[model samples]
Target: MESQTVEYKSDIPTKHKLFKAEIVAFLNTNNGTIFLGVDDDGTFLPEKVDQYKQWESWISDWIHSAFSVPVQKFVTLEVSAQNFAIHIKQGDKPPYYYKDGEGFNSKGIYIRNGSSKRRATDDEVRRMLKAQVANEFESELSNIQESLTFHYLQDKLLDNNIVFDPKGLRLQNVDNQYNNGALLLSDQSPRVTKIAVVDGLDMSADLLAKKTFSGSLIKQVDMTLEYISLLNDTKVSFTGAAARVENESYPSKAIREAVINAYAHRDYSLSADIKIEFFDDRLEIFSAGGLPDGLSVADIKEGISAQRNPNIIHVLDKINYIENFATGIRRILASYKGFHKEPMFIVTPNQFKVVLYNRNYALVDDDIQSWGNNKLKTNLSDAEQLELGFTVNQDHNLFDDSCVTELEKRLDSKDEKIIKLLRLNEEMSRKEIESYLEEAQTTVYNRLKRLIELKIINKRGQSRSTVYYMKANESK
Candidate 1:
């Protein structure tokens, strides 16, 4: 109803060229309605009722010859003599221009801007041309060597009971000439996916481990998931009776979906690599390029998706890595239902990031040391140490030397408390240790199990009668 995509004119122009620019603008834009006898303020005043038939004949002939494709079907004239409205729908084949003698040159292209028509800029014209060719960069033929192999992708497809044939590649927009999507799925794709484990919440701390997974996109997704699974430590909890509860550092399903979504939807035009970082209390996955055009975060939250790389998505879906399009975010959120911290998403024009919290490690203050070697000292700043709930002494030795052994060094402060209490009492039941430490029964149980796994302490008996003690031959 507003004048944004609608325009008004006092009367049909005698010189038809005066209104031809407006027609080209509407065809190039979202299409619009033009009222010949309406004022700019939207007041309808019929002035040229007698010339309606002549005006319609002239407009129909002009549009048919002006555009690259015939657009007479897009125009409609109101039959009512009291109101003259010519409706123009957006052209399916864009970059609509005036038929000048030069033959579709820069001078012909017009675009709608606000309430006026203007000549499209060179860049705008180029973009329109690209859009006309099916908005997919991955479908374009690649200049890379055609002697390419997709051994990894083939194996995955074979396992899924699907034949990996050359014709299949063409069907999926991949041909003998390797395209961008084919390059990504090739056995020797140069794109590398990386994961880095840091000693602290920030990268300023020491790098514990850094691994790069490359080659085919399928292999990279598989290898990355395997590597992260190895790092997903499990925590234990004990209650009234001896209970062993397994707590995963990060939800397995969420990590898989995030990694696959990153590879599937990433903008390959950008050379930036996908990065997965592990911190003290969270994990961050950064993928180059943001949401696709016309898509927003809210749209993704509602399970709406616009595929920026349809070719890549097609291959990924066929491999069964993606069950459905637009369901990755919803699946990621569902995986964190019982988790204390929800996943966070940060989207920008050129980048998208997913931040997942480590709920198991959330309450473990001294878990930061797990990332360091036995000889490594705390590199955390004074403020960071305080924030982590650690009281720094002048000596800077947060843990007593007597409480740390080669195997027990990885244990957190609470685990040390349980060990100290056990050593002092020689042997203590689960209830006795929980009572002495005045800690949550679940916390005590997790610590006790961790100590046992480290062989720093031994648990004897079962159920409510279970008691823990340090190994007799082991020295503190």
Candidate 2:
């Protein structure tokens, strides 16, 4: 039957162009077998026996001159007394095009489409080029001459009863010649892994803390995880009978999987670093390189993965850093099912970001109606106006008189404090509120929830970057 990898020719065609297309198609695609004596209807008609050697010679010379690299080794001619078959193996370096002045540019690259050969489109050619680069990049040798150390990786492998000797390293593509993958796992590789904690939601805010970890990538994974774990605080709730319900700010498994995914799949060719930013409302992990070719965000969410660095994945898998391929995104989503806000993935041509919101700092939905309440012309109670330190002027009106009266009736002292703080600033984060009031974070959180319920203020942004603003107008 006709397929992408098989083409049948009834007899030797008169023109060399027909053979050229089929051979180029096979080299661009997977290895294919071309049967010379077979017709579309499966009838066998042999070509002149003496012409077999001539045809083979012509094809070999044409392919060698047309491609940038020698393709003679990939082309083989099988000539039996009764039949002839031309077999072409897929080329390692692809986008094989016709020689210049053959009436085509790089877009002249061809691939098998069903049983026919067609020129590749610009996007298709680009994908083929990227795939070629990705496959060769990790196994390529690096110039780093420093003696490599793998104490961390060795210990991890030894714990699992796996030997990590030089021979084993070469087997895993980490040879003494120091491949790019080896540079990544080296103790003094130039790659940097950093985490930044910001006070505000975006980088516009002050930097509270920043930590950089360098060394072997495997060791960086552990060090980064340990640093993040310190910030993944647990909240304890005591209801009754000495029972406590504890919840972490971010799920441990989800963060671990994301970190592992960053290290294993990130593009090492770029000089960019892998960064993790912690804001008051959310955590974001940024890795160099976008989704690997032939993959989309939806595909990843559905558990489809394309490894950009197979050798890194191989070494990581040996050390138990990655349990299964293509399951990281699924596991991350599953870790937040039902209760936590779902994670978000942002992909660009050069970068991929994972955003995880803090479950405990989620905004109360009641605050949605209170946005834009600043235009309301209602007067506030004397005590409420005094607490907010505002006079009911046309522009400074905090809420409608009715909404303000309702708010004053319901707000406790801490609620009043949060509302007062939001009144002074255009917006305030949960942490900022906590700091201003010198109160416990949970206490500030509860007070903000109450203010939201009273419709005195509205929540804006999300995650650690979330901010509270006084409602511009109150809903009827």
Off by over 4 Å in 2: 1-105, 110-131, 171-176, 238-243, 363-476
Residue 72 in candidate 1, Cα distance off native in Å? 10
State TM-scores per candidate: 0.60, 0.57
| Alpha-carbon RMSD to native, per candidate | 13.4, 12.8
Clashes of 1: 0
lDDT of each structure? 0.73, 0.73
Q: Candidate 2 — number of clashing residue pairs?
A: 15
Residue 174 local lDDT, model 1 = 36
lDDT string for model 2 (1-476, tens) is 87877888866578655567688788887678898766785566664556677766776687678655567888888878766788898776677766556454674578888888988888878767766676677778777656667777778889989887644554233334667787778776789898887756799975656788998898889989987876675554433333456767789999999899998888777779999999878899999877774457998998877778877788888777887658999999999998646999999756889998887565323233443343342344434543564333211234454555466456665575565455435477888777656778887788788777776688878898888888862231
Where does the lowest 10-residue lDDT sum fall in candidate 1?
392-401
